[model samples]
Target: MGTTRSGEAVGTAFGEYAVRPVRVGEWAAVKALRLAALRDPVADIAFLDTYEKAVAQPDTHWRERTARAAEGADGMRQFIAGTADGTLVGTVTVLVEEPGTTDLAGFPVERRQGHLVGVFVRPGHRGKGLTEVLFEAALEWAWEVGVERVRLIVHPDNARALGFYRKAGFVESGITLPLAGNPDGHELEMVIER
Candidate 1:
């Protein structure tokens, strides 16, 4: 995959959709997509945050979040898939973790890597290979940024996502992260080396 500008369009099976990093001014769209994702049926296991929590956040929170990701600085970038008419239908964010730095889970980062998070696609856009396109753009960016490998954590109960990740060439890394609320629950870590 080649590098794409913020609004450059890419053609996919369903139609013309742009798979590119979001612009800083698109904070409202980012917040809306996130809220929609949180409302998904599998969101409880698929995401670490809740719709109520995200919806309650102020505009400044969303603006700052989008600004940071839009800047692609601090090792974070968020890519969104939008239709020709400018409707955002999906998103995926990549966060790079440096060696010796602790991850969000408080686990020590043993190597420089890209961690995929906040992956989501609208229900109507499912089964059309849109997720793969999104992943390709994200992985391309990650590899270009010098990550040795790319990884994502999925809850054990999210069979749909687990199947997709496996099919996408990610293998279990033998790491399990304790779930935030459920002491007995854990997320399985999957990785793909560059």
Candidate 2:
């Protein structure tokens, strides 16, 4: 566990890595980390967007996206685990969903909640507890924002992700969302109430 420090920073120690929110000027690093995540073997099931699409996005898009998630943003925040030298090794983004808004699946959001998305840890950083630290920062921010709960959608075939979510205290909400191109396949919704 970590203590809340100045700003939205969490003083969690993971060897030489520190977990903190992304900065506006670090857009390039953000884009780089995301692209690397999309190149992973399970990327097809772990991420909603493909590397081809993300790679095609212009620099401006990455800049604006990072700006939206930078510190002080109320709608969304992205937390990253970085080395002492500033190499980002993992990341997770939380998007605050208000009551009455439709989620990415077009389903109504019945309560104020945090939607966890784009969770990734570099392959080399895996098994070092980086992802757990990232999640702690993200969940802390979400609870601070007064969300009722935090939720994440996972592909049914993504066993590793499901196991992690369960270990992190998220339980299935009994909701299954249809996959875009595969009508027979669906994603499961898991949540951790605040």
Candidate 3:
């Protein structure tokens, strides 16, 4: 049943699953999935925001967030994976960064690129090749828009994510940022050039 032009179903272990952008009216779904992600066991290292803070956000915030990444947005896009039953199982967002602008970390963008963020998959859906499929879709969008490269930040202790990103053709860029809370922890930057 998943067959929207922008939301083609990618093959999955159980059957077919769609990977597409979030819709304007689907803010609730986006908010729910994000809260679920923040509740995940690895949330501490996997995400920068706390579950408490995310849940505290007003509905308008979620609405604006979804709208900014919806199908018509120019600077960002959020891709979600939906099952045959219409349940969202995972998501990823890509933000276009210009060379002259600064990023969330206050560092110069340096190059026009796609910054991948809000990456997640449900606990039950791990290791089914679904993540790779989602990534393929996101990267396709990034290239379609002419990004020079794509990059994501990962905590050094998050071995699972590091392994997955590496398998997906990303390599260490030799840039690391100090973690805010823990002085010794670092988030390593990984990139894949077009």
Candidate 4:
């Protein structure tokens, strides 16, 4: 359920739930839980990639994705919140995007940074502070990876997500990116600097 090798108190709540990186061989469960997240009601604004694309992915795709998050030296992390029953309730993936010619959002790279994405909390688990625990673990991972800044893009219209990011100490970086599928959509870039 977790990276047993790194059971270093990633985060805990009520001593019942733990947020941490998934184990190396848990790719199947990771794939299933992430697919469940993509089906959430607000998925359209919450994700740049779609469920159709994710669901159609082969087992190899999920394997690679999970493996990278679990143990990739390239500085990627995927954290999950699990209950005593072993049910995954929330997830957040942080990828260290190195400075380069261009980015997924078509922004010119300035310096090595961490990009937060694939954030999700099951509807039934909302308001439980699980998201906070997830974010804490993610930020810790970013710092461990030597990222100078961590950023996330949220739709300007999604007030809920904006609040969460703000509460986590992320501020508007005064930057934006054209929404991938809908050019008219406004993506507010928010960041927390190390």
Best by lDDT: 1
* Candidate 2 displacement at residue 117 in angstroms: 0.2
CA lDDT of each candidate?
Answer: 0.89, 0.89, 0.85, 0.81
lDDT (Cα, 0-100) at 150 in candidate 4: 92
RMSD each, Å: 2.2, 2.1, 3.0, 2.6
What are the runs in model 3 whose C-alpha is more than 4 Å off? 1-14, 72-74
Error of 2 at 5 (Å): 9.9
User: Which residue pairs collide, candidate 1?
Assistant: none
Q: Write the per-residue lDDT of candidate 1 for residues 1-194, one digit (tens) a residue.
A: 44455553233334577777877888999999999999999999998899999999999999999988987879999998888787889999999999999998999999999999999999999888889988988898899999999999999889989999999999999999999978998999999998
TM-score to native of every candidate shown: 0.93, 0.93, 0.91, 0.90
Q: Rank the candidates by lDDT, best first.
A: 1, 2, 3, 4
For 49-125, candidate 2 gives per-residue lDDT tens digits of 99999999999999999988976476999988888888888999999999989998889989999999999999888
**How many residue-pair clashes does candidate 3 contain?**
0
lDDT for model 2, please: 0.89
How far is 127's C-alpha from truth in model 4 (Å)? Answer: 0.8
